[model samples]
Target: MEEVIVTVLSEVRCHLGEGPAYDVASDTAWWFDILERRLFEARLGKGEAQVHPLPVMASALAYVDDARQLIVAEDGLHVRRVADGHLALHVPIEADNAASRSNDARVHPSGTLWTSTMGRKAQTGAGAIYALHGGVLSRLFGNITIPNAICFSPDGGTGYFSDTHENVLHSVPLDPATGLPVGAPSALYRHHGEGGLDGAVTDAEGLIWCARWGAGCVDAYTPAGERVRTVRVPAKQTSCPVFVGADFGRMLVTSAYEDMDEAARAADPQHGRTFLLDLSARGRPEPRIKLGAI
Candidate 1:
């Protein structure tokens, strides 16, 4: 396979871009900028991205049990549902640790919410991985530091989760419904370059595609951590990735311009841009869980 090119679909100029998810049924894409405390959406055919600000910072999102609402990660997990022309919170995740907040989350085929959290200042190995089954949370693993990219196989047998701060990726056995691990996590691979990882996607052949933040690239890897190909991103801090569009042919990326200097900003003009990369085939996107509105 060859590395593909990602094009800027829209610029939101979010301070810290992350969390890209597609609403396949609606032909729309959704993402968030944590620092800006906002969620963004765009129709499948639209070239522009629109932002909807929230009172709390949303670090990540996953489909709740309901089809019309989403669970977001920030100070805590919250249920955001559409009602009366607004996305309102229905349930809240009471994070016990103030210094810890979520970075990425994915809904398993069995409908469990899996997310990872890191230190407030980006400190390494200071976070934990969690599984939210039926609205109850459990720490699946510890010493994660910074869990970034994540994706599971079509059959939901194998799973991959990464911590960019450690520059390592680990494969674990996935329990479809509970999102629990049957055994120990096996080490897959680690990045040898400058940037870390952000979000990830699973392709048609069960290949793992990961966004390399700060390195301006996304890579496809085998389950054992063999690099298959790399897609070069135009800007810095390529934070999130999701396969959207009909049949999941379009690769949607979210970038960040957070904590950048004038010189750094000048080097990359596409920061905070929502990009789209066309692929040979679209991957199936994870289904969204709708948490009923309160």
Candidate 2:
């Protein structure tokens, strides 16, 4: 078990730090504090991070281009004006339901978007996964709780996602042309009770790297469910992993200090901070959302 050293990149603490995405064109990265309703961005290697306020609980985002970002907020999917930090409603998805909010999300290689929504109270079966293609939004699954691990395989033929509370990872066959699932999803891996699965990302080698919430580490698994590598960070509540930095040779992990008491925070000063790890494997840029005239 080879270990990688984790370095704290930012000291900002988030109640729930998730949704990490790198913008290659801008040489920056973006993440969100869902509970705080804040968005953060910073240059790859230089400068201070900038914080932007969101009107709603902004869970995840995908790059629309260098100048705009597509976001899944509490209300619905929106197009964010990067220059002015303005968000415009693009598609309405359960906007009237205050109990349900956007959760995990990612874009597909075919310019489509896949995002999930969950109940605010963590109610059972109060969530579902949705896919947006060619200006149409469709639900993929229902009766889900704590949706996470939304990623795709390198070839774009497989889609991976999981419900944190279920402690299982699933893989489904996808339509390459439309980036939608063509068949039923099956279990690829099960975490048992070690820790719940959270956000995940696929590397250039087609491996899925997942953050185990209470395990303080990120594990990589092959499509066949074999554990290949494990990289430990200092934070106990690791939230998500995103490949960033020069040549995509680095992994940026987000953490959370939410619900931690004074003694807990004192023991782990880096609890909610962001961390960077130097990795040998490279990563491809996340797919950009192709908003055709929307």
Candidate 3:
């Protein structure tokens, strides 16, 4: 276990910060405060983050270009113009269903967008994973309680996600041509540690960097389920981790303070802040989403 020191990047007291991703075009980092209905973007070592309030509660996002973004919000996926922060509804994904909202999401190397929906109140078995391609949305799996870690392998041959409530991570074979699941998913990793698996991202070398929700660290594991390294953070409820910096040599971690009580918050005042860690491991840039309407 290598002890890595992380610096506080943002002190924005977020309730449930998640969906941290790097934008290669702008050379910046972006994430969402799901409960606060806000999105934040910042340049490394620059100034304060520029905050934009989303019309609906947004969970995850991916860059469409340097000037636009694809956001998965309470009303489904929308195209947001970055210049004026204008959001236009592009696709209605469960907009009529008030019980659920979008959660973890990412873009595939094959130009497809994948996302998950969970019950707003954390209701059991009220969520599922979905894929959006060719202007169509399809559900991949169902009966999920809390979906997280929706990421893909470096080779784009596999997809990984987890049901946090179950503390089990699963993987599925993906079709290279269509970017859809080719077969059934199998259990890849089970968290018997102090924390459950939350959001995750795959490194350039095909290692999965998972944020352990209550463990206060990010664990790097091989594709074959071998834990190799651990990087600890100051916060207890780590939400997600994104590899960034020049050539993706650094990591930015997001955490939460949503469910903590008074005593817990006092014990760790940096619970909701973002952390930046200098890393020797390099990472590949995230693929830009290819939405049909865009």
Candidate 4:
């Protein structure tokens, strides 16, 4: 593998930074500090970032259109107006359950959104994954401990997800047009390392790039589950990775300082900062989410 240069993209520290997304139309990057209930946005190459306070703990979001966004929050799915940041409840997912909050998520090539929820305390078997399409939310998996790495392949025919607590990555076959699973998921890779899988994204060539939460690195693996490349990150708790830039030539990664103590924080000064990586692999743009009743 070639040398990868990592640089800081934003200095704002997040207690539990997670989701990272890019909107091609506005050339803007967006991420969240889940524990702080805050959202951060900035243009590519822009030094300054705009912070927006959110009402609920939101972990992931998908572009519904140029004017609106669908945000997956602790309470439910919210439609956010891009102009003024006004939010309206669009749909509810476990709104009655106060124990869980939204986690990692991603959109499929067919415009369906896949998201997960987990207990606030990382309680075992307290998480589940769901798929949202045409205004309906369908539960896909349950009894998950810490669901993460929700991503899809370039053609949308395959889906990938991981249970960090289990350290196993699984792959499922899907209907490319609807983003619904056509077959059961099977184990693709099992990690026996320092950290578990956090979040991941699929490249244009169908390779899976995953962030290792406590290991301070992003790894690339072939569809056959072979590790092919690894890029070191400055932060130890790297959480998520998203492709950015006009040509999707660069990747944006998010980290967290949620579970660190003073000593750990001091040792890892860059624990909660965001980073950008220059790599040879390119990514495809995220698909627009389709909302409203079908």
Candidate No. with top lDDT: 4
* lDDT (10s digit) by residue, model 2, range 1-294: 357876777789989999989987777988999999999887866866888988888888998877789988888998998899888999988877789989999888898899999999878999999999998998998989989999998788999999998988999999987889999999999887667899999999999999999878899999998888988888889999999976888998999988899998898878998888888778889988987777
Which 10-residue span in candidate 2 carries the lowest summed lDDT?
A: 1-10
Better of 1 and 2 by lDDT: 2
* TM-score per model over all chains: 0.91, 0.97, 0.97, 0.98
Looking at candidate 3, the ten consecutive residues that score lowest on lDDT are 43-52
Clashing pairs in 3: none
**Model 3 over residues 97-216: C-alpha lDDT tens digits?**
899998998888987989999999989999999999877899999999999988899778999999999988899999866679999999998889699899999999999998999889
| Local distance difference test, candidate 3 | 0.88
TM-score of candidate 3 on Cα atoms, chains taken together: 0.97
List candidate 2 stretches off by more than 4 Å: none
* True lDDT of residue 175, candidate 2: 91
Best-fitting candidate, measured by TM-score?
A: 4
Model 1 over residues 110-153: C-alpha lDDT tens digits? 66667777887877678877776675667788787778776787
Q: Kindly give the number of clashing pairs for every candidate.
A: 10, 0, 0, 0
Per-residue error for 241 in candidate 4, Å, reads: 0.2
Each candidate: what lDDT?
0.75, 0.89, 0.88, 0.91
Which residue pairs show backbone clashes in model 1?
Answer: 63-289, 64-289, 64-290, 65-290, 66-290, 66-291, 125-145, 126-145, 248-282, 249-282
| Residue 280, candidate 2: alpha-carbon lDDT | 78
